[model samples]
Target: MKKIINEMKVRLPSHSENEAVARTVVSAFSALIDPTVEELSDLRCAVSEAVTNCIVHAYRDLPEGEFGYIYISLRLYDNREITVEISDNGCGIEDIKRAREPFFTTSESDERCGMGFLVMESFTDRVSVKSKVGKGTSVLLRKIFSPHTSEEE
Candidate 1:
């Protein structure tokens, strides 16, 4: 089993501004392992998409004056593998398979491209989502860097 080098978890309100908080925390955690510029960029984008999904879809059903919480965790292993887990205690997806299809969105507005999961999958090596209609949703993302990456600057 690989030992964990470092790990962090944060819980924030399901608000749009917290999306930046997720990116900042994940990027800072990744910096310790010396990821390449491209890798870091991908990590940031993936995290942003995941967090945005939680903000937009998870707690969407809350009453006008209330909001749920979003939980994000970052774990780094000795083998240079990173795992990111984002979960929300809000209205969950009714269909997992259908939700993952590219361009599939339930929002009525056209502004939503319905590519959040696709974007997350493109940047991460693995993506998994679990949810129940009323329990909430959880997204897990994993990516391993090449063995030859340079040390942190």
Candidate 2:
């Protein structure tokens, strides 16, 4: 029985410092469902990747010292389901399909591994993306924890 428990929305600057803020907020929110340690870790890592992408890539074209915003929304369900939507208002991807491919970064620097979506997909139950070239991008990640059945076992 999936029912809405609560929902939270946060809007912060596209600064690196706020990445941890987003991750911590999701961790605390999901903790209400008593997720396993591994589940919490996976959720945090996935959120970190999504948020980091916004800070690093989303506003790369902004003029010096200019920064945009990163918006994150979290919804918790009675069935132990949590959906996180991370979005950015900045230059969007030109090729959504190719951008999702591993090691397909637009960055010229050697530091980028281009594994953001891969990490998100690997960690979450479902990963979705929406974007336009000049508008912005949104990545939605959903994770559902199984009902407790240890007593039956």
Specify the highest-TM-score model's number: 1
Report the C-alpha displacement of residue 6, candidate 2, in angstroms: 0.7
Residue 45 of candidate 2: its Cα lDDT?
A: 94
RMSD of each: 1.8, 2.1
For candidate 2, write residues 7-51 as lDDT tens digits. Answer: 999998998899899989998888777787788899999999999
TM-score of 1: 0.94
Clashing pairs in 1: none
TM-score of each: 0.94, 0.93
lDDT of each: 0.89, 0.89
Quote the lDDT for 112 in model 1: 92
Candidate 1, residues 1-153, lDDT tens digits: the string is 999999998999988998998898998899888888889899899999988988788888788878889999889999999999999987899988889999999887537988988999999999999898889999999999767534545
By lDDT, the best candidate is: 2
